[model samples]
Target: MKPVAILYDDIFLKHDLGPGHPECPARLQAITESLNDLRQDERYIWVDPPEASPDDIARVHSPQYVDWIRQNCEAGGSVYPALEGNLVPETYPAALKAAGAVIQACDKVWDGEWGGAFALVRPPGHHAVKSSAMGFCVFNNIAVAAQWLVDKKKAASVLIVDFDVHHGNGTQDAFYSDGKVAYFSTHQWPHYPGTGSKREDGEGNGIGANLNVPLRAGDGDDEILSAFNDRLKPWTEERKPEFLLISAGFDAHEDDPLSEIRVTTDGYRQMANVLKEIADDHCMGRWVITLEGGYNMKALGDSSRAFLEGIVG
Candidate 1:
């Protein structure tokens, strides 16, 4: 197996939410610090990506929303009321880079240059919608990457597996009507954003394509992993996606202040391993993952590193 490609840049650290913000720059710093050994090792390759163009973002976001963010940042605005995120002056460029980093991860994995790739980005994107930003998310990074693949004809179908503690309402909204992209998520129910019910599956042509397995707050490894084995695995086998993507978030860790889920370090690895199996079996091992929400710095670093280990193994 080839080494996993890591997409990162210092610019990601510049997307400061604000002082004492939970989604502050320290999250990335913690991840970087924890993964320092792996980064230096020959098994992992780190790549700095270019800023995503407005055209790139337009693939998934509405033109009007994109313009709003740009203008908002240029005018020295610091807070985005829609998402409740502090949008500093440098946030505009940082968000662009974040989207671009995920795109580059997809490009590398699609090209078979790496078995898998992870975009350790800030301003976590799973909560951002097509026309609005929410929950500390600016632009929906994973959505843009998947849509880009569809637009370029690089993939006929894509599978998005979001294992975040909170539901990826934004990613689901992006592909709700498109059968070409199957959105599957396992999130805490009755949580933030108040979405992700199993009944809220995709509409129109995508009715059966979206799968949401909403777990309870205290659901841990046994409960969460069983959901994957019983539902996600069989569903992926039926769909046989051409590519795989993950909205990887570690906020479910027991120590995280955001949620009450009790997933351990090993639990993250187990989930990643299952997803890796699905990718290997159906997608020729083409996988791209992007960071989302994970507030507990120590747990975030440990769990994310474990996820990488599961992927590379």
Candidate 2:
């Protein structure tokens, strides 16, 4: 079997939010510690990705917004109210590496150099919009990668599947009016960011290209798995995407402090299995998974390990 690439960099650890923020560097530390055993396994390979160029990021973000972020980071790191985090000098470069990691993962998988790849990055993106950062994310890493696949790689169609507990408002907004990319998300409704309603389908050329399954606060593994099997499966079969991208978030884990959803580690495994089958059937197994959110360190580590195991199997 072809190995899966694990894209990571120590620079990610330098993107510190604050002294006592939820999105801290320890999130990656916990994940690395949990997956330490995988380093000895031939099925996985670790890679250090290059920083994303300005043009590369411009695919999803406006030049003005990008410049604003860079200027702020350079000027002693001010806090953007929407981002809800304190940005240090390292934040901009770390965000660049984060997006670049996802782009590299897509290239490696699309070139058949690897069957799949997981971009272990932070700060978690999915919440960053085109104009500005929000919800502790600097750049919309997965959105940038999806656009890269469509624009640079010339992929006919790309699909983004986000299972984050919070709606991927940034991702949906990125492709809401574009037909070449499809966005699907299963998130908790009446939650943070307050988007992702069933009635908020795509518009214009992107009609029917966006799908959202908003679960309740107490919803658990059964609800999420059913959404994947019943909703996402049929939607994917019709789209038959050329490339698949996953916004993998473990905050839905039962032990997670951020949300009430009760997804367990095994739940993530099952979801990964389903997503892998979809990719294998339609995309020739061309897919990349990028980290999004999971506040509970132990839950994040364990759930990520389980998901990778399922994907590799």
Candidate 3:
């Protein structure tokens, strides 16, 4: 089996979220440093990702929104008042690179060149909508990759699993009417963005394609893992997706200050193991994981390592 490819670079750390922001560069730095020892092993491969092409990013985002981001970045200031996230000139390029990492991971995995790929990037996506950026996300990386797969006829159906503490409202909205992409998420109820109600299964043809497992603020490993095993597993079985994408986030960990969902590092491992089994059974082990939200530096590094170990071990 080929080694799991990790798409990473220092450039990702350059998309500054500004001082005192929870989504800071130190998060990635912690993860990178924790995985440093693993880099010496042949089972893992680290490679820098190229910048995402604007045309490809347009796959899931509006052209006008894309241009607006460029203007915002070029203007050299933060984007959207109240968002609190900075958007320096380098932000646009960094966002492209972050998104591009996922695209390249998909390409490499689809080409049978890797067992799987993990895009360890910043300016974390998933909250980015088609028309605008939100929640510290500048671009919807996983969404764009899923759209690209469908556009290229690479996969008839995709399974997007979001383990973020917050609901991926942007991703859910992007594919709410498209049956080709089935989004399953486990998040803290009444959390940030406030959008992943169980009632919001899907819309139109995509009805029944979306599943949301909203946990209480203090929900922990057993509760969260049960949702994965009982709900997400069955959903994937029914859909039998041709590709698997994970919006991997560690903010749900017990130590993370961002949310109250108390999932442990072991919980992340168990979740990844289940997802890996699904991929092995349905998609020939083709899986792509991208960073999302993880605030506690310690938990982020530990849980991330556990998740990767589950996938590639």
lDDT of each: 0.89, 0.92, 0.90
How do the residues 59-149 of candidate 1 rate in per-residue lDDT, one tens digit apiece?
8889999988899889986566776757777888999999999988888788888878889998789889888898889899999999988
Which candidate order results from sorting by lDDT in descending order? 2, 3, 1
| lDDT at 30, model 2 | 94
Q: Cα-based RMSD of the predictions, in order?
A: 1.1, 0.8, 1.1
User: Residue pairs in steric clash, candidate 1?
Assistant: 78-87
* Model 2, position 144: C-alpha lDDT score: 94
Worst 10-residue lDDT window for candidate 3 reads 77-86
Lowest summed-lDDT stretch of 10 residues in model 1?
Answer: 77-86
Model 1 shows how many backbone clashes? 1
Please provide, for model 2 over 1-313, each residue's C-alpha lDDT reduced to its tens digit, 9 standing for 90 to 100.
8889999999999998887889889999999999999899998899999989877888989989988888888998986678887888988899999999999999889989998999999877899988889998989999999999988789989999999899999999999989889999998998998999988789998999999999999999999999999999999999989889999999999999989999999999999999989998999988899999999999999999999899877
TM-score of structure candidate 1: 0.98
For all predicted structures, in order, the TM-scores are: 0.98, 0.99, 0.98
